[model samples]
Each structure stands twice: as C-alpha cells, then as structure tokens.
Target: MIPIYKPYMPQNIGVEISEILYSGQLGFGKYGREFENKLQSFIGAEYVLSVSSYNIAMLIVLSTLGLREGDEVIASPVSCLASNQPFAVKGLRVVWVDVNPATGAMCPDDLKSKITKNTKAIFHNHFCGYLGDIESINAICNSFGIPVVDDGIEAFGSQYKGRKLGNLGTDVTVFSFQTVRLPNTIDGGAIVFKDKDLYEKALLIRDYGIDRTIFRSSNGEINPDCDIEVEGYAGLMSELNSYIGTRQMDDINSLLAVQKNNAAIWNDKFTNLDTINSLKITAGCIPNYWVYGTLCKNKTKTIKDFKEQGYYATGVHINNNIYSVFNNNVSLKGVNEFINHFVAVPCGWWFENK
Candidate 1:
C-alpha cells in the first residue's frame, strides 16, 4: 500500500555521513555555516540561522520577539501543533483566526475582526503548503505596527508571488527540515529574519547567549571580560545534520518539480468527482504540494475506500483548539466546515518511483 508521506534520502548520504563522522568535528562548524549560506541564497533572505529542529526554530523566533506573558498572538486554529504550541508554552495567549474552508488557510476577514490592542504578533501558517492570503495579513498587521511570524514548516520550497515565503516581507519565517518534509536533514530547521538586529541577536542567543566574536582572546583562551547579556537555549544545528542538509539541497529543485507534477495529475483526476472537492491554491503562488488535500462529504468513508484500493488517506491535521492544553472554546464556522471534510492522500516524490 502507498503511504501518504515519505522521507527522501539521497543514495550517496551514507558516504557523506561517514566522512563527517570520521572528521571529529561533529558540532556546529563549517558545514553548519555552509548550510545556512545555502538557505540564505535559496530563500533570498539576508539573515539565516540553522537550528536543531523546527520546534527550536520557533523558540528562537519567540526569543527575538520580546513578548511578555499574556500578550495575544493571532494564529490559525487549523495547523500542526508545532506551529502554535510554542505560543502556549511561552505564556502567550493565542487568539484563533478562522480559516477559509475553501483553501484550508487563514481567513483574512476573520483576522481583521480579531485584532486588538493585546495582539503582539500574527503567526501565519501555510496549511499543507498551500499559500495563504499573506499580503492581506501583512497589510492588516502593518497597520497595528505588529510583526508577522510565518510558520513555513511545510512550505520550505513554496514561492509566493515572485519570491519565496521567507523573503516575502514577513518579519520572520521559520522552516522545518524534519523527516517527511521536502528537504529532510534527518531532523533540522532554519530561521530567516527580515531585521538585521534580530539576526545578530539570534546568533548570540542560539548557543548559550555567549558572544562568539569575542568570547575567546586572540591566543584562543577564554576572555574574562565576556558577559552573558541574555540567557539562551541550546538550539544550534550540529555539523552532522548540516552535512546531510547540504546534500539534500543539491536535489531540492527536482524534488519540488516531481511533487508539483504529481499534484497536477491528482487535480485532474478528482476534478469531475461529485463527491470530492479539491482545496484551492492562492493566486500567484506555486505551492510545494506536501500532500494533495481534498474535501469530501464523508471523510471516513473516503479514507476507507482509498485504503481498500491500496492507497493511504486520512485527515492529516486536527484543529489545535480541540486539545485541552489550549483551553480554547470559541466556535469557528469555517474551522468546523474544514475539519469535517478535509482529507489528504499521497502526493510526494516517492509516487514517481512506484
């Protein structure tokens, strides 16, 4: 049976990994810097930082935001837990922004209605790698002088308008390189910053808040003068993960092309099916097509039928509000509609070989 998601590993990765394992420089070093540089070039962003995973990437972005307890953040209810859980863990209140059932993305109108003086930032999640109305979301947040944090975990290679998601005027964009994502590095992530100051701050805070530029004297001895300005977490990516990421970057373009081509085929096949309605793609955006999502009248029946035909299918993401940890009870009309019918099927590069 074909599965809905698959991790792509380069055939030559064993040789590359063995080389790094034997080099004795297993920590963040040349390869980590190289991976960050590659990401900067690909995303057309001025500042990029490689981290251990997407969860750590979000924490690093939150560190730069300077948000206090109880500050409200506008975010979609329909997204992976990795996208919104960081806010709750940071003691910030998450104000749910309803999604457009047609697209499975945040509804700009709902966002406009929810903003208030308590709103510190807006977290824009690109659902299933399908682009959202970020232009409108940016315009709304800009009026209030709020920053926008793009949760690009599933949108690593997606292009919005003419630029990539990270470089599209958002204040911060975080990407996931975890297994099953387009460019898997075993498990890793990256952050792209629009502000140079924030980028510098992240550099210091990513590894115990020590200033690497002057932490050691000219003779390689620890400087007694170095002071820890801000306490930080251990979030930097390791040299091993970085080496794998650099290798994966080599084939990113072709990997993306195959997913797009497969999605187009699925789109055509389901177009005339009266029981199935495909999700909509935003205008001027080329999605990475992490999975081919569709809405049906009976999600359970559809999934079972696919399984019987030797294909895996199911609801990929559940609305975060349903969990008790969030403690949210607001009823959202669009979210209700989306949760009822949304289901995903296999649409990765692996299908090409099958």
Candidate 2:
C-alpha cells in the first residue's frame, strides 16, 4: 500500500556517501560547513545553522533567546508537538492561538488578541507547507516589538511573495530535514536567523558554547585553550548527514515540482466531490504541498476507503493542548474543527504518478 510519506533520496546518494567515507573525517567538519553555506545561499538567509534534528534546532533557537521562566509564547494549536513543546521545556508558558479555519494556520486577529505584557514571542507554523498570513502576523508582532519564530518544518521549498519561507521577515525560521521531509538527511534540521548577532550566538550554542576556531595562531594553527560562556547542547549535524543533505539539494527543485504537480492533480480531482474540501492557500503564497490534505465530511470513513484502495491516509498531528504537559483545556473552535475533518495523503516525491 502507498504510505502517507516517504523520504526522497537522490540517485547519486551512494556516491556522496562513498566520498565522505573515503575522506576519513566524519565529524561536523568540512561537509557540515559546506552544507550550511549551500543552504544559506539556497534559502537567501543571512545565516543558517544545521542541527542534528528539528527538536534540537528549536531548542537551540529558544535557548539562544534567553526567555525567562513563565514568559508566554503565542503559538497555534494546530501543529505538531515539536513546534511548541520547546517553549514549555524552556520554562515558558504557551498561549494557544486558534488557526484559520480554511488553512490551519495561526489567525492574525487571534494572535493580536492574545498578546499581553507576558507575551515574549510569537510562534507560527506553516502547516503542511501551506503558507500562512505571515506578513500580517509579522506586522502585528513588529508593532509590539515581539520576535516571531517560524516553525517552517514542512515549508523548506515554499515561497511567499517571491521570497523563500526561511528568508521571510521572521526573526528566526526553522526547517526540518527529517526522513519524511522534503530534503531528507536521515535526521537533521536548520535554523535561519535574521539577526547576525543571534546567528553568531546560535553557532556557539550548537557546539557546547565553545568556539573551536576562536584562538588561531598566525599560521592558522588552532589553540587548545577555549572559553565556554553559556550552557549549550551537542546539536551539531554530523558530516555524513550533511553530505547526504548537500547531495539532495541538487535535485530539490525537481522534487518540489513533482509534489506541487501531484497536489494540483488531487485538487482538480476532489473539486467536484462535495464530501471533500481542499485547504485554502493565502494570496501570493506558493506552497510545497508536503502532504496533500482535505477536510472530509466523514474523515473516518474516508481514511478507511483510501486505505482499502491502496492509499495510506491519516491525520497530520494531534493538537498539543490535549497533552497533559500543556494542560491547556481551552477550546479553540478552528482547531477542534480541524482535528476532526483533516486527513492527509501522500504528496511527496514517491507519489508523482497519482
């Protein structure tokens, strides 16, 4: 049966791995640096930091911000736990914001209403690569002098008004390179920063807060002594994963093109069906269509029918508020409606034919 999602591997991935094995250096070295440089150029970001996983990438971004305990961060209730859990783990309170009924994205009006003195940051997710009303949300956050962190895990190749997702005006944008994502590297992710200073801080945080090349001699020889200023985590991307990701970048455009085409096919096919409703896209937003989703009148029966027809379909994620750690019993009308009707089918590279 066709699965809901599968990792896309380049045809020459074996060659890329062989080169890394022959080099004898497998830590976060040359390939890692190359990957970051290539990614920065690709996404047009001022700075990019590659991390081991999306969760750790979020941790690095939140930790670098130095948020205080009990500080409230406004986030959508329609995202995966990884998107908002980092705030709670960092001792910050998560204020659930309702999503747009049509797009499953943070509602700018609701986001504005949730802001208070305790609100430290605004966290927005590009659900299933469908771009949200980021410009409006960013404008609201900018008016309040609050930073916005974009959880753009499924939107690596997506665009908004001609700019890539990560290059958008958000203060910090995170992208996932997990196995099921667009540009898979087994397990890796990236963080892009708009501020140069924050980028520098994140670099240190990714490697245990120690600068390995801080004290180079006149001949470029490294100094053994280093200074550790702040607590950090081992979140560096391995050289092997970096090499694999770098190779995949070569065919990213083609991969995204196929996903987009397949989504268009599904859109046309479902247009005449009254039982299924396609998700809406904002004006000037170009989605990558990570997972083609529709709001079905009878989602349970629809999923069973799809499986019986040799297609795998399922809900994208459970709302984080339901979990005990969040302890958020608040009712979000849009989120409740979304959780009941949304169902996703494969829209990745593997399902180009359908």
Candidate 3:
C-alpha cells in the first residue's frame, strides 16, 4: 500500500551519517550551524535556529513573545496538536479561529473579530501546506501590534507571493523537519525570526538560557562571571540530526519539484469529479503539496476508493478545539463543515519514486 506521507533520504547518505556517529563531536556543533545556514539561504530569512523538534520550536517562539499567563491567543482550530498545544503548556489561553470551509485555512474576518485587548499573539496554521490568507491575517495582527507565529510544519518549500513563508512579513515562522516532512532530519525543526534581537535571544534560550560564549573561559573551564539571565530550555538539535538535515537540503529542490508535479496531476484528477472538491489555494501562493486535500461528498467512500487503488488517504488531523485541555468548546461552523468532508491523499515524493 502506498503511504500518505514518507521521508525522503538522499542516496548514500549513510556514509556521512556513519562518519558523524563515530566522531567524538556528537553534540550540537558545526553541522548544526551549516544546516541553519542552508535553511537561511533557502527561506531568505535573516536569522534561523535549529531545534530538536517542532514542539520545542514552538515553545521557544512563544517564550520570546513574553506572553503572560491567561493571555489569549487567536489560533486556527484545524491543525496538529503539536501546533496548538504549546500555547496551553505556556500558560496562555487559546481562542479558536474559524477557517474557510472551502480551503481549511484561517478566515481573516473571523480572526479580526476574535481580536481583543487580551489577545497577545496569533497562531496561523497553514493546514497541510495549503497557504492561508496570510497577507490579510498579518494586516489585522499588525493593526493591533500583535505578533503572528506561522505553523509551517508542512509548508517548508512553499512560497507566498514570491517570498517564502518564513520571510513573508510574519513575526516568527517555524518549519518542521520530522520524518514525513520534505527535508527529514529524522526529528528536527527550524525557527526563523523576522527580528534580529529575538533571534539573538533564541540563541541563548535554546541552550539552557546560558551564554555559551561567556560560560567558558579560553581554556574551556567554567567561568564564574557568566550568569544565566533569563529562562530557557535545552532544545538543541544533535550534530547527527543536523548532518542528516544538511543531506536532505542538498536534494530539496528536486524533491519539491516532484511533489509539486504530483499535486498538479491530482488537481486535474479532482477537477471534474462530481463528488470530490479540491481545497482552494490562496491566490499568488505556490504550495509544496504536502498532501492533496479534498472535500468529498462521501469522505469514507473516497478514502476506501483510494485505498483500493493502492494508495493511502484519510483526514490528517482532528480539530484541536475538540480537546478539553485547550478549553475551547465553542462550536465553529466552518471548522465543523470542513472537517466533515476533508480527506487527504498521497501526493508526495513516495508516489513518484514508486
């Protein structure tokens, strides 16, 4: 059976991976720095930080925002738990924002209505790599002086209006490099900062809030003058994972090309289907097509049909609002309508390789 998602590995990467494994320097080092540099060049961002996972990446982004306890954050209900759970864990309240039923993306109108004095930040999740109305969302957030954090887990290679998602005027954008992502690091993520100061702070906080430069003296001994000024976490990516990430970056362009072509084929296939309506991508956006999302009249039957054809398909994520931990019970009309018909099918590198 074909998989809905699969990690891409460059041919003969084992030699480099094996070399890194046997090397004494297995911690976060040169490899991690190289990975960040490649990502910076690809995404066209001024500053980028490599982290252990997307969850930790979100945690680090939120930490930089200085949000207080019970601060309300407007967020899309249609996203992975990893995308929204970080808000609750950071002692912030999540205000559910409705998505456009046709596209399964955050509706700018709903987002404007949800904004209040208590709203500190906005979590705009680009569901399954389909670009949302980010320009409009950013406009609204800017008016209130609120920061926007983009959950670009499935949108690494996607572009919004000629600019990559991370540099598309958003305050902070985070991308996942998990196994199923386009550039799999096995398990890793990157955070891109639009602000240079926040980028510097993230550098310190990602490694236990200590100043690595001053923590040790010239002889590598612990320096007594060095101090831990702010709160932080140990969220550094290992050198092994960083080496793997760089290998993925080496072939990222070709992999993205195949995924885009497959998505085009699926778009044509669903165009005339009587029961299957393809989700609408925002204007002026180029999606990486993590998976081809559809709104089927008979969701169950559509999934079964795909399975019978030797492909895997299903709804990728449940609405985070359904979870009691989020404390958001307000029923969202668009989210309800979208989830009931949403189905995702394989349109990644695996299909072409097969």
Please report the TM-score between candidate 1 and the true structure: 0.97
lDDT (10s digit) by residue, model 3, range 216-300: 9999899989998877988999999999899899999988898888888887887888899788889988988889889999888
State the weakest 10-residue window (summed lDDT) of model 1: 345-354
Write the candidate numbers in order of decreasing lDDT: 3, 1, 2
Candidates in order, TM-scores: namely 0.97, 0.95, 0.97
- Stretches of model 1 off by over 4 angstroms after superposition: none
2 or 3: which has the higher TM-score? 3
Q: Please give, for residues 252-322, the per-residue lDDT of candidate 2 as tens digits.
A: 89989998899889888888788898877889998998888788999899999889998899987988888
Itemize residue pairs with steric clashes in candidate 2.
none
User: CA lDDT of each candidate?
Assistant: 0.88, 0.87, 0.90
Sorted on TM-score, best first, the list reads: 3, 1, 2
